[model samples]
Structure formats: C-alpha cells, structure tokens
Target: MIDLTSIYHRAADNYCYLFDEETLHIRIRTKRDNVLEIVLLYGDQYEIVDHQWITSLQPLEKIGSDSLFDYWQVAIKAEHKRIRYGFILKNTEQEMTLTEKGFFSFIPEDSGFFFCFPYMHKSDVFSSPDWVQQTIWYQIFPERFRNGDPLLNPAHTVEWGQEEPSLTNFFGGDFQGIIDSLDYLQDLGINGIYLTPIFLANSNHKYDTIDYFTIDPQFGNINLLKKLVEECHNRGIRVMLDAVFNHCSVEFLPFQDVLDKGEKSLYKDWFHIHKFPLKDGDTINYETFGFYEYMPKLNTANEEVKQYLLKAAAYWIAECQIDGWRLDVANEIDHQFWRDFRTTVKAIKPDLFILGEVWHDSVSWLRGDQFDSVMNYPFLHKSLQFFSYDIISAHQFTEDLTTILHSYSDNINQVLFNILGSHDTPRVLNECRFRKERVRLLFTFLFTFPGTPCIYYGDEIGLDGGNDPGCRKCMPWQEEQQDLELKDYIKTLISIRKETSLLTSKGTLYFLPAVNNCLAYYKQKDNQVVFVLINNSDTEIDYVLPFSLSGKKINLLLTQQEYAAESDELSVTLAPYESNILSFYI
Candidate 1:
C-alpha cells in the first residue's frame, strides 16, 4: 500500500459546513496515487458503550483529483447536531483506518481516534437568498437598453440605434425606458434584473462613479429609481444594482481635493497617492484599476473609506429596497472589507443577494462570509472553447467541467451566476460566428446546467458584436430590426427552465461518455431524467444512448420527437450542428 504519512487533513475547502442545524457537509483528501477508495465511519459523538463506539460506514465518492491529491466528499445529517468521524482507506491489496491520531490496521476503541464536530449551529450555516434558485437573470447596460424620455438625454447623445458605440457615447437610455419595457422582460420570463452601475458618473458606462448616493441624471432621479424598483418588484422581478467601490472617477470630490491640494488635502488618505504632487500623463505613480488614469483606485483598507462605501451600499437597499449588489472589481479589494460588507448589508436585508464580479476561481470569496455568488466566467470560457471554437474534444470538455463542479461545495455551485455573454465579453452570437445552431446548443447547455443562467441585454434577439464597445449596442425596439425566431427560441428555453423543477438549479449532472465530436449528459432528479446530446462535428453521426431506457417513454424537449426503447440500447442519428434534449419518465 502507498504511504499513509504523505498527507493528513480533515477538510481543506469549505466542504465542512452546516447547511442547517442538522445537515453537515464533510470531505477529506488523500494522495492521488495512494488510495483507490475511502469509507467514512461516522456516528453521533456520544454513541459509545463498553469501550466500543457504534458507527455507520458510508462510502465516499471520488469527486476530483489534482496533481497531488484525490478529493473525496460526502454529505450527512447528524440527528443530534454532533458527529464523530474517521476514514478507512483501501488499495487493491491492503486496507487501513485513518483517524485523528494516525493510521491503523483496525478501528480504535478510544474516542480520540475520531475527529469530532462538537455541534452544528444554525447561526454558522451558509445560505443565500431562497429566491435566487428560481431566478433567470437579465443583465441590462442601462445606457444601451432603451430611450423612453429623450428630454433627459445628454447634450452629446446621438440617435438611439443609428450610431455605433464608442468608448464615450450615450443614447439616452434611462429608468423610464426600463419601466416602459417591463412587459418585454416579463414576457421573456426574466425574474431578476442585474443593471450595470446606474449611479451618477461622467461616462456612459457609469463604472467611473462621480456620486454613489444619487442616481445618474442620465438614468433618472431617486423618485424614478424608486418607481423602477417598485415596478420590477410588482412584476416579481428582483433588481440588483452594480456597486463600484474598488475605485472612483477622477471627477469625484475627494479625488479632486487630493489633486488640488496635494499635501494639504484632508482626504489624502482616502486615495493611494504615491507622491506629494499628482501629475497626469502616461506615467502613473499611484495604483489604478488596470492603469486607467481617469479611474483612481480607492483606499478600501481605510476605516473611513469602508464606512463611506458601506453607507452607500446600505442607502440603496434601505431607501429604494433594491434586491442586491453586484460588486465591481471584487477580487482586488480585501476580504475583511467584504466580510464587513456582508454584515452591513445582511443586517438590513437578510435575503439580499450579493454577487461578485470575479473572472477566475472564486472559492475564497464564496466561503459564506463574503459574496453569495460570483460571475462564472470559467464555465463560459470552457463552453465557448468546446462548442464555438472547437478547440477541445467532447471528452476534454466534460473532464474540465467535472473539475469545476468538484472545486466548490454543492451549495455554492447551485447559486453560481452562470453567463454566456456579458458587458465585458464578445456577444454570444458573435462568438458563434452568427450560426444560429451553435447559439441554440450553447443556450441549451446553459439553461440545463445547474445554476442561475444570465442573459445579456439584446442577446435574445440575435444582437452580434465583437467586444466591449461593440457589444454595448442599443436595444432594437422595432420588430423588423429584431431576430424574432431567435428571441422566441430563448423565450421557450426560459419557459422550459421555469416549468421544469429538475432543470432549474438543483439537479444531479452526469457526463455520458462519447466516442466522437458529439457530447451528451444526463440531468437526473428523482425518477425523471433529461438526456442532452450535442453534435459539434460537421458530419451526421449515429449516436447510441449510454444508459438503458427499456420500457420508458422518451420525448425530445426541443424537437418534440417521441420514441420507445425496445431494448437496453437505443440509437439515434444527429444532424450536423444539431442538439437534442430527451426526457425519460421511468
């Protein structure tokens, strides 16, 4: 047997957590080459008599393996809110028991051999808003959504859809415009709206914040915002506003004071000024977000700055009753600030959703102390690489996705904000090179995947753009200018997601093995199973179902095709660039 002294740990990730007072998630890790399987021997900590402990042996699934170790996981309920657990490791030829003390040939009678979870408390449980699981979010770039009140349009504002978007351009989109298009969003089946920075800022994008307390004049006044929030809530839609606390626009009053009175400014500590005198040009002495001169990084470490930003976050929820805050540049800020931010926000509104804009692995921020969820950019990248770019084969795609699912706890993965295209990336249709079939397959995977899927504004109607400025095109109100077919397809996908409980956020995902360029997976919840198949290759292929479907009724969700399994094996032919979602009721 492999050496048991190579490593030792209880649970490295946030895998050990109390979902509630009784349910506990526990996980352990061992050397990748050491153990073939592990069995968790656990029971109530006090269930012992006459030098023997009563315990239950439960097998641990090998969730994932990295270069050094293999991660095994399990979730159990401690009826008494206390647990004593130990691990039994096995190889092909040998078996050994592992405990808090060390490895042994047999289970030890002493209680010290087991690791103890004294008690599971309700207060320590990590949870997000209940409404998040059923939500289908629609992200709106406010300036590009609509133009309801042209009177409030900026002096330099151009015609709504006539002008191409530039770095600095406005089309007079406002809250009233959003209010006017409530029916459109509601009919499209969106239950949540994530609006990018609507606070007062000089730029049309509004990330460069000039004021946080007041709404942008171009967007509307506080009354208009209240009305917007009320309308959205009335329609059962939750509104999440963007919070850019990492930095502020150079035009901000505090930054202006620092620029005018270099050393004498009382607000000098508010920002990170490298030198006494601040000069402009290519050379930047102080820290900024990606070296941009106009957007100076805020000194979030300071207590004063923390209080100021916390107040701004509290102001929106307390005054307008906004549902949540989507933090901008969330990773650059300190963790303590976010922990405090969560405390401040959750105290006022307990169920408020907090989403962080993190592009990479965000396990650190999602430990239940900081943000509720983060933007799933890793999923998007891997998806595009497999479906749109065809850089990876079907097997590699599944392997990469499995690694992602195993990286986080089950609870964190359920509420993850999954996105295909956003304000930051190229439009999904553009990424697919305007192929409608590829777009369909992409959305099919997105809606069926286990998370809350987000739709960027105008993507439903076949809006195509390269990147940032190009992706921020004005919403087309006219029926002739829109792709009605694609819009209807997306509407149907949302309807399926809402109507089907298993497809929404909680479903067991299984990646079926495929031989060629075709990909398939099964999403099973209870007795219902949804089998999704996508043909990425150019040639038609006859694919066989991976599992036995004998005596079960099969109905394809998208095409409405029906079939009966005569034998244990069932085969179907998939056209090039085609997709199918088969539902089997057993």
Candidate 2:
C-alpha cells in the first residue's frame, strides 16, 4: 500500500525555490520506491477555461533516493510568472492526487486545491556571489603559514617548525609572510584564501579579538594587510578575513571598561553580564563562548553593540578590498544581527562572499538575507568517516550524502564552503593515519564534488596533527620536507575542475550504485558524461560501471588517456585505493 503520509511537497523554501530568475525548481518527496510516477499538475493560477482553471501536465523525474524517501524535481517556467501546482502520484496499488488542501482520488480543476506560488519575486531567490561556485579556497592560520619577515617575530617566538604546535606557541607568521608566499599558493591553483583572525589580540591564535580595527602588530600594520590583499588580487586570488563577532577578548576596550566600572560603565551592555561585579571564580557570572572565561559573548541585541560590530564588518571591505567574510561562532549570534550585517556588507560590495561557521544543519542562515554559505561540516564528517576512518561503506556514505543534497536548493549547495579539515579538527592526513593513498582518494573526491572546496593551509603537503592546538602546525617551507607528489596531485585536480564546467554548478554530479565497496559518480553536461570511480577497499576490485559506454570516445581526465568503448557494459579494474575519472561524449 502507498504510504499516504510519506508523500510531501511545498511550493516554497527548500522544497520549491528559484534556480534563477527565469527558472523555478519544484520538488516532491515520497516513500522510497513507492510511487511509480509523479505527474505535475501546473498552470498560472489566473489562467481559466470557461470559468474553470486550465492546467498542463508534466511528469517529474526522480532526481535522487535515500534510505527513507524518493526525491523528484522539475524545473518549471510559468507564462505569467505565477503558478498553481499539485502532484498526481500513482503507486502499484492505488493512485492519489495531492494538493495543498488535502488528498484526492481525482484531479482538482479549481486553483484553490493546488499549491500556489503567487509570484516569482527576484528577492526570494537564494543568490550568492557567482564566482564563489568556482572558487578553490585555501585557509591560512596567520601564525603558521610562513615566516616571511623575521623582524616581526613575537617575543619568545620559536624557530619555524621547531616545537610541536601548542596553544601558547607563536611562529611569527605574518601578512608579509603570506604576501611572500603568493607564488606558492598561485602554483597550487587556489583562487581564494581564507585567513583566520589577524586582529590585535593577546593570544597566539588571535581568535579572542582585542581590537577589530587594527591588524596585530605581530602580523602587520593596516598598510601591510592592504598590500597582502593587493598582492593576492594581483595573483587572481581572493582574500576572506575571519570576523569574530559572537565573542571578544576580555582585553577589548569596551569589555575592559565594563570590568573596571561594573554597573557604572557606559559600555556595560556590550557583553552579557549576569548581576554585575564580575568574578574570576570557577562559576563565572557572565555568558561566554562555551564556558571560556576570557571570551565573553557579545550582546548583539544591544543597539550600540550591533552598530559597533556592523561598522567593523564594513570597514575591512571598504578599506582592504577583501572578497569575503567567514563569521566565527555564527550560529550563536541573533539572526537579525546577521540580517543587518548582510545588508550592510553587501551594500558596499555585492559580490562579497559571506560564509558562516556552522557545524550543524544551517538552512536557517543560508537565505539571501543572511549568509551566502556555511562551513559544510557534515560533508567533512562523512568524508572522514568513509575515507579516513573506513567506518562507513560506500553505499552508506552515498545514501548519507544524497540526503544532505536534497535538503538545500542547488544554488545554496553549489556555493557551500566544503572543508576537509580546519584549525578546530585533526588534519586530514592525521585522520587517515598518514596513509598517503587514502588522502589521495579523499582529495580526488573533494575536488570532483560540487560546492566551493577549501584546503587547510598545510593539507596539501601532507601535514599531520590531531585536534585544536595540534592541528595548528607550522607550514613546512623547505622543499625536502614537503610532500611534492601529493601537492602536485591536488594541483592537477584543481586545474581539471576549473576547466570542466561539468564539475561546477552547471550540471549534475550524482552517485552510481556502489559495487564491491567501490564508490562511483558521473557528471553529465549536454553530450559530455563523466564518471569518477574509486576503489575504497584495500583489496583490488574489478568494478563494473552502471552505464554502458558503447561506441563512444572515452577520455580519462587525470591521465588524459583516450579509449573506445567496445561493449555496452564497461568493466574497469582498479587497484587498492585507486580512482579514475572517465569522460565520454555521445
């Protein structure tokens, strides 16, 4: 019997949204494999025939299926830019019509029974910067990328890559260091650089920001920061600075004033204080960033605090000409504050990328009024679980990924900030137990996957470390210490991704069935169809592709080798941990 409750559809939000100004994507979900077919009953709500509404029928194609549901999508164009739609679903045992009002046994000609899209409002579309989809980002922790100017080394700064990374250690990596390393990043084929906090602060990491206006003296002055952005821009690299608005250091002037004057201070509302007269005891009296005594959470709801932070957000873009912002602890802040922040920043530069640091589901923040995208930690966890830890099978991993893909509109998914590792997590190499081959497969999948991909500063060189302070290791500048082969492999992937529109947001990239513990997916754009097959298991596997490549020209992207498909079904033999990207045209 059909699961009547499982059939789902809405004419707005993630289920239905604008792909572009002219195209609207409407989606419906049903019990997995239950519905034999979905017929879209759609027409402009105002269009009528003899005092009754007239509609057209279009069959919806199944775009994806996860464990519990089948997802179907159809892009529609309404002649009057308005639509009334409903689904006619047929199962093996029964057929039903679903509308906004209720289920029906027969088609409803009245517009009142259908889901309504009043108008195609341009503002409703979730639009990010166009260039963000193609961007390959590199995240740099300013204290450890390189030591270009030894003159600016902080007191007690250790020699580069000397001691193991620690919470308190500083290796004197400054903006000039990054400026000097532009050629290296350029060679790696990265177009965007996400630099962690460089603001004046007492700690080595600078996450506890003391002054948002000034660049840390240890890093560089404002002029040098400008020069770094200028230098990066010259090399066709975009620069995005970290903005830590959720909390700030105790040493920040406003916080200091509140500390000294308590209830009498004019800036007492700058931070969340419980019953004044702050204490240093274990039981602190104020809200902070996850119980950290030094980082007091800001009172974003306070009017003065809101304007103060919003001004600082505008300052960098207006002054340094930066390309984006990566908000720290973004989920903790009030939504209206971010809404205002978006309006303020985008007014200055419409193309600026605004990415939020959200570890969990973030559909609430990805609307056009807020962030352009979020740090896709779900993608990180799943990738590490499959490739690094070998805990999940390829079949299970693909099911998990498909669920996430259907949760957001394609526009939001394409601009997502997909990260493998970061300052807060273990290095990808460390997660893979230093297996170079596992890292290779992981990198291959990341570059081939949709959304904007980011590389942690030293990930290219096979840097290995555990979480937090350990993950913040110094970048090895010496050629002998670097993993040259891994770097080249990642570089090649970036180059191929830039050249192939199939890998970008232009086309579809979905998983094929998992076979013999191997993962496979294809990217199809027009006559060009591309497949990426990876042998996840340790043992060599003779994998069979789901689609036939008979009588077509096939080209392996990584190796540029050409082949002619002799049979309809293609059988590919892959060694342990080996992956290949094969492409063919009709």
Candidate 3:
C-alpha cells in the first residue's frame, strides 16, 4: 500500500521555482523505499480539447534521498506560460493520483483540484550574475590583512602580527596592502575578494559606519581604492564590498541631531526613537544592531533614507567598478527596501552580484526580487559538527548534507556564499581543534562541494584563532611564519577545481551510500564523472562502489595516476583521514 502521509508538495517557494524565464522546476518528497516511481500530469488550466483538459506527462527523476525521505524533481514548461499539475505515484501494490485537494483513484479532470502556477513572468524569474557561480572567493578583514602604507597608521598602531588583536586597536591595513598582494592572491588562484566594511567609521572593525560617502582614511582614499580595483580587474579578480546599511555608527550626524534635539530635531524620524530625551535610565530610545548602543539601526522605510542608501550603493559600483555587494543584516531591513536595492544596483550594472548576510533558512529572501543568495551557515554547521566535533556519524552527515541541498533550488545553490569561516566566526583551524588532519579533510570538502567556495584571508596559511576579537588576527607576512606546505596544498586544490568543470556547477551531485566510516559522493556532467571518497576513521577501510566500475579507466585527480578496474565491483582502500577524487567516463 502507498503511504499517503509520506507524500509532500508545495506550489511555491523552493518546491516550485523558475529555473529561467521559460522553464519551471517542481519537486516532491516521499517516504524512503516506499514509492517506486512518480509520474507528473501537467497542463494549462484554461486550454481544453474535446471537452477534456490538454495535458502532458513526464517522469520525475530521483535526485537524492535522506534517512527518512527521497526527493524527486522534474523541469517543465507550459505553452501558455502557466500550469496546473498533479502526480501519479506507484508502489508494489497499487497506484494513485495526487492533486492539491487530495488523492484520487483516477487523474482529476477538473483543473481546480490541481496545483496551479499562475504565470511565469520574465520579471519573476530568479536570475543572478552567472560569473559568480564559476568564481572562487577570498575574504579579507581590512584592519588585519596587511599594512601596505604606514604613513596613515594611527599613532597607537602596533607591530604587525606581533601581538593579539583587540576591538579598539588599529594596524593600518589599506587598499595599498591588497593592491600589493594582488599577485599573491592571483598565484593562489583566487578570482574574487570579499572585503569587510571599509567605510569611514570610528571603530577599528569599521562595522559602525559614520559616513557612507567616503572610504575610511586609515584604509585609503578614493583614488587608491579605484587603483586597487583597476589592478584587480586587470588580473581577472572581482571585488565585493560590504554594505552596512542596516545600521550606522552612533556618531552619524542625523542620529546626533536626534540625540541632541530629541523631539524638536528635524531628523528625529530618521531613527526608531521610542521616547523623547533620548533614553530614560536603562531604556534605550532607539533600536540598534543587537544590544550594542554604538550601532543604531536605520529606518529603512523612510523615503529619504532609502534613496540616500541606494545612491551610495550605486555610487561605489559605478565609481570603483566593483562586482558585488554583501548586505549586512539583510533580513532585518524591510523586504521592499531590498527589492528597491536590487532594482537600483542592477540598473547601473545588471550583472552585479547581490549577496545577503542571512544566517538562517533564507528561502523567503531568494525569490529573484530581493537577493541572489545568502550566507550558507547550515553547511558550516553540519561540516563542523561531523568533522570537527564528531557529533554526527558519516551516515548522518550525508543525510544532513542532502537536506541542505534540498533546502533550495539549483540556481541559488550555485552562487551561495559558501564559507567555512569569516571575520565574525571562529577560524576553521580553531573549529577543528587545532588538528591539521581534520582541517585538511574539512577543506577538501569545502573546495570540492557544490557552490562557489571562499577562503578566509589567513586560512590557507593555517591561521588559528578563537571567536571574535581572536578570530580577527593580523595576517602574517614573514615567509618563515607561514605554513608553506598547507598553502601549496590549497593552491593545488583550487587549480584542480578550476581545471575540471565537472567539479563546479557544470556537474550534477548525488550522495552515495556511505559505508564503514567512509563518506562518498559523485558529480556527473554528461559522460564525465568525478567521484569523491573520504575516510573519517583512524584505521584504513575498504569501500565498495554502489555501481559497478567494470572495464573503466579511472584517473585519480589528487595525483594524476591512471588505473584500470579489473572486475565489476571496485573496492578501494582509504587511509585515516584520507580523501581521493577519481575521474572517468561512463
């Protein structure tokens, strides 16, 4: 008997989203091992022939399965640019039709009972810059990356990389520093750079923006920034600046006017002030970023505020020719503001990448109108829990990973801001408990997994630090102080990924049955297949491929060695914490 409770589908959101202006993708979930197949019956609700609705039939392919459910998806298009769809699912015993209303013994003739996709408007299509999917990103914290020009350093500036980092101190990292290291970044195969907030601010971290129109004096002036961007563009590198529009430093002139004049201030409505006289004892008069008093949240709904911020957004892109913007606290601001933000920025440069700094499930923000993609924290959580803390088994890790993949559509997944660590979080090495083997294993997955991957400034050199203040350590410049071996290893991985298109968004991903503390997966693009296997256990284990590899030519990607499979079943051995990538033709 088919389990009715196991079936699930939705007409909108990730379950159904536009792949392009003309193509639409629909997905469904069923209980694991309970359903044998799913066939889709779809048609335009209005068109009819011979007193019957015109219809089309197609089979849904099984894309992935978790511990409890299997995911199936199909892409389709309606001649009328709209569709009403239903499913016919089969089991060992019987088959039944599933519509939006309920299950039936036969396919519903009335379109009212089916799921409806109103229209596929060209404007509704979820589109983003295509170049982002192919680029590898590196993130740099300006205050700590390097000190290229000591002339502008604060009088209290300290020696580079000699002491611990603090919230208040400065080290004079600037645009010249990044410009000076463009060759090094190019040498490491990085084509995109994400710089934290660099606007004029009072704090060393620069998250509290005092002015949106000017670059921080300590970092560099407009000329130096334009020069840095020009140099990066010459090297095929893209630049992304952080937008702190969610809040501004308490020192902002408008907020200061509000503070001094209270109810009588002309800019009193610019902020979310609750009561006059600013604050009453412990009660704050206005909202702020978290509980901190220095960072006051802006009323994004205000017309003047929205236009002012949008102008700033377009100015930097036009002036510096920057390629992207990472919006901070994007979810907290009004959705309408972001919709306007997208329209404003895209007008100047249609291909500008707009990324949101959301940390949770961000499906609502990725509907093509608001954001292209958000920071993928779920990936970081699952990876660290499995590899760093050993809180989950390899089997559980694969299930969770598949769940993450199913959480969004393929288009959004391709350009996700996938990072293991950023300036706000603990360094990847610290998360792995200072174990180099585990760190190496984690990074292997980072670069190999789907989506555009990012490396923190000092991560490739084995930088270790704890959370915030600690995670923001200065970048080391001395050759002897860096980990050359690890750097070379990361560089090679980037090179291999760039060389093989299948490893990027060009290939399709599927998780294999994990066995004996070994996790396995593969990507296939046409006849080319690249298989990845990793052993999490201490002792060596033999893993057998689920599908036969009979008479196939396999070339190991880590080391370009060729081998032939002698039998139908190919069993390979993996050493402790070892990972290998194999490429072959089907």
Best by TM-score: 2
Q: List the candidates' TM-scores in order.
A: 0.93, 0.98, 0.97
The full ranking of all candidates by lDDT, starting with the best, is 2, 3, 1
Candidate 1 similarity to native, TM-score = 0.93
Query: For each candidate, how many residue pairs have backbone atoms clashing (under 3 Å)?
Result: 0, 0, 0
Tens digits of per-residue lDDT for model 3 on 1-586?
9888988999988789888888899999999989999999999998898899988899999998888899999999778899999999998898999999999988879988999899998887777798887789999999899899999797789888777888888888888899999989999999999999999999988899999999999998999999989999999999999999999999999999888887898888778887777778887878999989899899999998999899999999999999999999999999999999999999999999999999999998998888988989899999999999999998899999988898988888877888889988999999988888888888788888988899999999988889899999999888787888889888878987898888776334898877877889998877878888888879897888765678999888876688888888888788998888888887
Write the residue-wise lDDT of candidate 1 on 329-387 in tens digits: 99999999999999999999999999999999898898789999999999999999998
Worst 10 residues of 2 by lDDT: 501-510
Estimate the overall C-alpha local distance difference test score of candidate 1: 0.86
Candidate ranking under TM-score, highest first, comes to 2, 3, 1
